[model samples]
Target: MTLYETIFTRRSVRQYDQVQLEASVLAEIRQAIDNEKQLPGQNARFEIVNADRLKGVAAPHAILAYSAGTDAALANIGYTLQGVDLHLQNSGYGSLWMGMGKPIEQSADYRILLAFGKTSAPLRAGQGDFKRKSATEISNEDNAIARVARLAPSAVNFQPWKLDFSPGKVVVRPDGGGIRKLLTGNLQKIDLGIILKCVELALEREGKAVTALTPKGGGKTFAVEVAFE
Candidate 1:
């Protein structure tokens, strides 16, 4: 399946085969990460290392992400790695976002970890296999982009975002209204970036050429404006 298609079926895989992948396959993943485009101007660093360098995760391999601790920098890391997460799962590997996992010799730049390795764990059969908020709960418009984008995973499955669709653009804002404001701190910014990737993919699938991804505001007022043709 394509990365966009994988979004519906992707799962946070924990169980792994414990066997390491071949050198060639590991090299391919590393190159892919090296090539993935970040959010316009943001620069985040990623290191693919064996499980020996990691703590807390049991997967045989992992991607250690490092970046400045600012909101845009953290979100940029999330937006970037979430695509890697989908691609790994689509290629029949298991991946999980591990906030607690870190490089054993950690530096201040380390932001988050993505644990991935060979696994027998399965992907969901389809959209119904996912447990997420209803269309009415997370979006202002009941459309394809919002439907698939809402499927993007969040920290603690909080799904703390609001999708507002207008012609040629989609505004993804931190959903701080009502009782659905579960996302907080640095993780929430990252979660917003995660969903933005899904929104971009959905737009591209619809033949919309995304012209820009402009992040607006900061802290509680954080939001991303995805402009497209």
Candidate 2:
């Protein structure tokens, strides 16, 4: 399946077979990560490591994300790596976004990790298998983009963002009050980026040319605009 199709069937896979992937497979994974486009004006770095280099994670491999602490940087990591998350699962591997996992070696810019490896777990049957808020609750308009984009995962399953659709573009903004206090870390910003990838992929599948992924604002005002034609 393509990344967009994978979105409907993907899940946060926890159980793994614990076998390290072959060098060729890991190379392909790295190639995908290296080629993932970042949001304009943001630079995020990703590193692939083995199980021995990590703590608090069971997967045999991981991709460590490093970036500045700014809201745009965090969201760029989310938006970019989410494509890797989908690609891994779409290729029959398992993946999970790990907030608590860490690298044995520390770096000042380290932000988060995506744990992935071979697994026996099954992919979700489809969108029906997702336990998420209804379209009416998460989007201003009920449509295909909202349906696929709402499946984008968030920290603690908070789903703390909403979508507003307009001609040739869609704007995503924080959904409810008290999100910052409730989600102490900046994971919510990353969630915005992740969903932005979903929106972009859905648009591409519909034959729309995505002209830009514009991330703006900070604090309670954070938002992302996906422009297409």
- Which candidate has the highest lDDT of all? 2
Q: Cα miss at 211, model 1 (Å)?
A: 0.7
Model 1 per-residue lDDT tens digits across residues 84-149: 999999999999998777789959999888999998888999998888988778898988888889
lDDT, candidate 2, 142-201, per-residue tens: 988888888998878888789999999899886656755465467877888888889889
* TM-scores, each model vs. reference: 0.95, 0.96
Number of the predicted model whose TM-score against the real structure is largest: 2
Question: Please, what is the whole-model Cα lDDT of each candidate in the order they appear?
Answer: 0.87, 0.89
lDDT (Cα, 0-100) at 35 in candidate 2: 90
Clashes of each: 0, 0
